[model samples]
Target: MSFPENKLTVRSSADLATAVPYLIGFHPADGSIVVIACRDRRIVFAARDDLPAPGTPAHHLRELTAHLIPVVQRQQPITDLMIVGYGTKEHIDPALRVIDDAFTATGLAVRELLRVTESRIFSLTCSNPACCPPQGTPVDPTTSLIAVHATVAGLVARPDRAAVASRFTSVDSTGDVIRHATTEATARKAALETAGSTAVFEAGVHAVRSALRQHDNDTPLTDDEVAWLTVLLTHRPVRDLAVDLTQPHDQHVTFWAEITRRADQALVPAPATVLALTAWRCGDGVLAVMAAERALQVDPNYPLAHLLLQALHAGLPPSAFEQATTSTHPNPSIPNPNTPSEQE
Candidate 1:
């Protein structure tokens, strides 16, 4: 969902419709409601949620509004917003009304309210039938200039959300390789345990630097290297070091995605969370959510993944995390793994 810092103007509703897929990195699911917040004519934040069911209560719609308003407020100074709902009138109308009212209460204008069916788009706010026909206006992204500009700007609109999630799915047929590497890595860790916590911690720091160099050179880590790194990342200090090293770049995404997919199942949370953080920093919220959800699937109590999910849900920008990280320094204490007090 990343775009250049330069502003891309939307002259008409049709152009906005065409640009949505590119902005979110995928076409939204049917029955979904998308909110795009703008500040002083620049697109700032975007979020999506499912429309309420047919029999849903009025309070349920209120709950939806409750969830969205805070997110919009967190991205404050939002001058206006656009809401697009993909579904039938029965489902979309009520939800749109609740959301629009809620946003307006917060003093932000609703620029456009649109309902998108399979073949056409209907403007709920526009009464004029000439430009926005009563029967709805046809929207063909293939013929859209906005689509052309988005493509030329190197933005990709995946066919659907699932297609974006598939990017982090496990690589095919590497289970046996990872298993054998895990066994060796476990033995090596046991030997290092006898040496002291400092030795294991230093080894992990070295491993992190070496892996970064390998990724920089466009050389994927071997099965053994992935195993050792994932095992060491279980150490909190080591994981923190890895997190500090991650940057907002596609290279970091590729590097961590491979590590996440190749790690043994029990060791997945660390690498997956790192991948989530990296994607968030890159402005790829869809990927960040997918990766964070994957980590929680492996370990529900993983605090870092939970924190990342919270930030994304609150609509906080990546700079929020960058500022926090830069302001705090790493703890200086390092306990020896051989000490009884340090053993978990």
Candidate 2:
């Protein structure tokens, strides 16, 4: 099923008639640009027909190399995407407002983080592979093989967002890296681990609200694991249910109680876990900080702990902590008023 070459504007994909492969040629005054195909049709670039597809390592290399043209040119044209220059780079960077309007109208492009994570309508859509055989529907792969390389790299780069997340082994192997609602479960799991899992039975399941996006209607906790989650988040305030920190401090108590009661009824009660968790959840803030620092001292490899301190200190306003390290210095040239002369 090869797609045919097109010389005219593809106002929409409907204009494209090929199925196997396709070529979209872009001619600029500087050089002829070509986009053989992209994950999305909207992403055209400028370059020669000299690389593998986007999924291949070779193609990525070419993509990086082509950006040099613009740097040589001094000023980037509307279509310029990189300094190396790209094939479809001539299309013109859409204005932020234009892109927003386009998204509002068609809901297609995968450029924005939120856009990358928006809910997907899996049932409403079907890729060629869905009927062909479960090639994981092309969208969802057979296994999500949590690209260890990619994950580790991302974790290292983004300490705050790099969460201790989870995904079904299969999805982690094959699913698209994008965040469609289908991926929300994975993201939420990561938040659960990263947000707070140290406390055993004390329910402070303070996951970032990736939970709300996936199950916004307040769906009942059907899975035993989910019920456990309700139990774990007992330490969180009811106001935090929305992951909103602006709410009053006491809001989460009731939610925590319900969670505790559910967890309390497990066939085999895990009291040890509960007691340890109780200490964690009810512990004072200063104690938490000291414990956190001590944990760092003990084993600096703890991913969340390292990131925690980074976020804690870096996330503060400059003015708030700028002077915390201030120290008074004695002047060597001037004599001390009270005979403290031994300082060298």
lDDT, each prediction: 0.83, 0.26
Q: State each candidate's clash count.
A: 0, 45
RMSD of each: 5.1, 23.0
Against the hidden reference, what TM-scores do the models get?
0.89, 0.16
Candidate 2 lDDT, tens digit per residue, 7-28? 2233212222111011211111
Q: Model 1 Cα displacement at 328 (Å)?
A: 7.8
Model 1 error, position 243 (Å): 1.4
Top-scoring candidate (lDDT): 1
Clashing pairs in 1: none
Tens digits of per-residue lDDT for model 1, 173-201: 88888988998998998899898987788
Off by over 4 Å in 2: 1-248, 253-284, 290-304, 307-344
Please identify model 1 stretches exceeding 4 Å from their true place.
1-7, 322-329, 332-344
